[model samples]
Target: MDKHFLIVSFLFCFIVAVTPLKCVTCHLRTRTDRCRRGFGSCIAQTFESCMSLKIFQDNILQLSYMVCQKFCRDLTFDFHNRTYVHKCCRYNYCNIEI
Candidate 1:
């Protein structure tokens, strides 16, 4: 009985450890800061992380995008009078507040 219990416990731990991270996903956010389209959740793969991207035009926020990104990197850039900020996180739902 002890051996069986130990094996089951170990398996449960292993499964939990190997489970992929979950992240909030939204493709478009409205001006009122509400999800406008593609609202859902995603399970991140081994090479992926949760990413949030915010776009600002003339210092006013214009859009927000969130998803599970592969090979994610933190960055900020400007293009065509708009600034884009990209942020990445590893834990589950870490990008929720971004």
Candidate 2:
């Protein structure tokens, strides 16, 4: 019985680990911190992760976006007088808090 329990536990862990991660999806979030478009949820594929992007103008937050992105990387770049920060994470809804 103990051996059977151990096998069951291992199987459960494996299943959970192999399952895809879920993430919050928001195309555009205004400065008011509210989602303005494409508000929903997404399931990340095996090679994807939850990503969050924040756009700042003059050091003030102007917009935010979240989604499940493939080959996502954490980075910061400046363009057109705005700074964009990209962060990636693994796990369910992790981007929501980024």
Candidate 3:
């Protein structure tokens, strides 16, 4: 009985340690330089990162958004002379500045 209890306790600890955290989700966009207020709930899943993205056009900032992400490479991409800035974080609701 002692051995069984020890094994069960270890398994429970491992499960709790590996579980993912919940993160807030929201997107903000505006062509006129004003984004409306929005509210969102936390999402708990296998995703281990929260990401914030910002895009700019002709030195004028365009879109801003945030989402729970599965991968976290922390890189940026550009297309059609437009730039994409990507940032990743590990804490819950840490994808601010979007």
Candidate 4:
């Protein structure tokens, strides 16, 4: 029984240590000269990353979001008058910054 208990406890701790943490989430949209938004805590699944993005339109900050995302890589894109900035991380609330 003692051996069994030790094995189970170690396994539990290993699993918890290896798993990624939950993140905070939010969204914002800019209109003319102003932006409006809200934020909250969010849970992320295994194999997911916390993501944050800032969008610029015509060189002006226009929109932004924070989310628990499954994947992101080489993260930047631009088209026409819009630009997007992306950051991805695995720790809790890591998406809080742009």
Candidate 5:
């Protein structure tokens, strides 16, 4: 009984640790700027690594805008959808796109 309880507790802790819970304070967007940059066309290019993460912690809007530019040269977007494709950058964009 003691061994079973210990194993169960360990499994429960492991499950909780591996689970990806959303950050209520810092929810990251799943959008990618590839489509905005003409990704399917000849002008399309890969996203820059330097712009992968936020440049300024305080200014999320500015950082996101700047990062979008690394993929799309045009920064004057009318809306978020116009600048980035929703839920497109969730995983392995470089490997899949290239």
Candidate 6:
């Protein structure tokens, strides 16, 4: 029983250790922005989407690359879904429909 408990504990710890620190939805939005949008609107749109999801709205500055990885995993964005905006310089943004 003790050995079984140890194995279970280790597995649980591994999962917790690998789990993303940032919220999943926010991560998805962030990754989508990175693959599609340049930077400016990516930050703004991701921030707003994170706010709407009630996840990491106030902690954008503290976000790490790992959390961003979580976003990339959850998002299905790619080169095709990207759109260009011509406000001044050519800018791009992801068009995640769902």
> Which has the greatest lDDT?
2
Tens-digit per-residue lDDT, 58-95, candidate 3? 86778776677777557778889888888887766777
Error of 2 at 16 (Å): 1.4
Clashes of each: 0, 0, 0, 0, 0, 1
Model 2 — which ten-residue stretch has the worst lDDT?
Answer: 40-49
Measured with C-alpha atoms, the lDDT of residue 61 in candidate 6 is 21
Candidate 5, 1-98: lDDT as tens digits: 99999999999999875543221111242244222332221112345221223323332333221122133222222353333322112122221231
Task: Give, for candidate 5, the lowest lDDT window spanning 10 residues.
Answer: 21-30
Q: Which stretches of candidate 6 lie above 4 Å from their native place?
A: 23-98
Superior candidate under lDDT, 1 versus 5: 1
Cα misplacement distance, residue 7 of candidate 5 (Å):
0.5
CA RMSD, predictions in order:
3.1, 1.5, 5.0, 4.8, 13.6, 15.1
Cα lDDT tens digits, model 4, 1-98, are 99999999999999998775888777664545233565676777866778888788887777778778786653889977689888888777877655
Off by over 4 Å in 1: 1-16
What is the Cα-based lDDT of residue 25 in candidate 3?
62
TM-score of each: 0.81, 0.89, 0.61, 0.66, 0.25, 0.25
Winner on lDDT between 3 and 4 is 4
lDDT of 2 by residue, 1-98 (tens): 99999999999999999888999999999999999999999999878999999999999999999999999999999999999999999989999999
Q: Give per-residue lDDT, candidate 1, residue 66.
A: 94
- For model 1, give the RMSD to the true fold: 3.1
The prediction achieving the highest TM-score against the true structure is: 2
Higher-scoring candidate on TM-score, 2 or 6: 2
